[model samples]
Target: MPVWLIWFIAALGLAGAEALTGDLFLLMLSGGALAAVGSNLIFDNYVIDGVVFLVVSLLLLVLVRPALRKRFNSGPALPDRAKALEGKNALVLDRVARHEGQVRLDGEVWTARPYNDDDVYEPGDHVAVVHIDGATAVVAKVV
Candidate 1:
């Protein structure tokens, strides 16, 4: 019946929903509800309680959360030693001449092409997968 009770219930419900959804964003809203309820409880002043909670929640979501996510959500795009080979190394599995060949890297075979003429390589030659062009891998002799 009280606004404080409403805020607390809403917070608890959102937290439970976050447990089910596993999105992590809803948890921020739940945090806001908790702050609101806590402020209301401590001050018994609804206006100040609501304002403080709102400001806190917004600050947490906009400033704190993005920084935290950048640190914690490192995945394949993370430029670290573990993914070093992604932009380097390829094995020439086919007799390559000019602009067409096959290479093996990234745990799979791929159609390879060269950047220019007069570039030729043979099977078992180590090449560098310079870049990916569409469905093919562009290669250069490793030297």
Candidate 2:
């Protein structure tokens, strides 16, 4: 029945919802609810407590949430399988031509072709994978 108790309960509920959603929005609301509890302690006015909650929540949503989301999302990039193979060195296993060839890439044999139609790779040549087209790796002679 107490205003502070109501605010505290709302804060706890918002925090639990934040846990489930994993987004920063509900967490900001929970911070606002805690601020409302503080306002209730100081002013004992419902209007002041509600105003404090709204202002604090909006400030957090507008300012802190974006920065937190950016920090959370902008971590180091992780490459997928195709991107991971790019620029990796492979050993030519058979005579490679513009349209046809084979290479051993990372201990596994992969179908390969010259990155450029004019290039030719002899067996025992080292090449760098340039890109993947379906199951084939387009490779260029390593230097």
Candidate 3:
């Protein structure tokens, strides 16, 4: 049993663990184990190989891991449900005037009112959701 052979086995085991975990942490440890295999070739000493493995693993965890995680985690920030309805298209299910109306948004009926005081939306008209005011949707006629 050579020291390099032991490190190679450890690297293979750690790589299998990485596949199970799906996190890059174990993969970084596997990289360190591979480094130890290289160190064993140069120094041919188990103690120095173990030291190199520990140092390389820690460096990857502290320095490289955060950057990788941040890059992978970057995505669109989702707005809350209430805010998400803003600017959505809706259909006027009932006559819409400044005082009262009804519209269908996302297949759900919602209380609606014209965005402008004099504006009116007839049934079958397409409208844009301006904002939600309490239980009501402020909407504007598409045309």
Candidate 4:
């Protein structure tokens, strides 16, 4: 019946769509529709309410949505398995050179390569895992 009531209903519909999507985009539009309801109640003009809705929606989409998405998406700070192996000592199982080698890390033998192109490790030599590249472990002299 009233313009404000229409806007309120639209806001509720947008919020319902947002629930199904789980994305904040529709929620931002729903916020704009709610603002339109207030504008309609105050000015009682369709054009003014439309303008308010557009401006509020754009503001929320550009500014508020990013912060909200980041806050909700950034979950627990769990440690990465590969990153955990960095700097840990491993025993060279085979001659380790820049091109290829093998090392025992955490009781498991892994394909290895020297971090420095010229560095080489012999069997029984201890080295530190510099980083992991796919299935290979880049290692450096432990000392």
The model with the greatest lDDT is 4
lDDT of 4 by residue, 38-128 (tens): 9999999999999999999999999999999999889898898899998899999999998889999999999999999999899999999
TM-score (all chains, Cα) for each model: 0.57, 0.70, 0.60, 0.68
* Error at 91, model 3, angstroms: 3.4
Over the stretch 45-98, how does candidate 1's per-residue lDDT look in tens digits?
889878977887788788777876777687566564324444688888887676
Runs off by more than 4 Å, candidate 1: 13-26, 43-45, 73-99, 104-108, 117-128, 132-135
- All candidates in order of lDDT, best leading: 4, 2, 3, 1
Candidate 3 residue lDDT tens string, 12-44:
999999999878999899989999999999999
Model 2 over residues 80-142: C-alpha lDDT tens digits?
888889999999998889778899998989999998999999999999999988999999978
Report every candidate's CA lDDT.
0.78, 0.95, 0.93, 0.96
Q: Which should have the higher lDDT, number 3 or number 4?
A: 4
TM-score-best of 1 and 3: 3
Which pairs clash (backbone N, Cα, C closer than 3 Å) in model 2? none
Clashing pairs in 1: none
Highest-TM-score candidate: 2
How many clashes in each candidate? 0, 0, 0, 0
lDDT of 1 at 95: 73
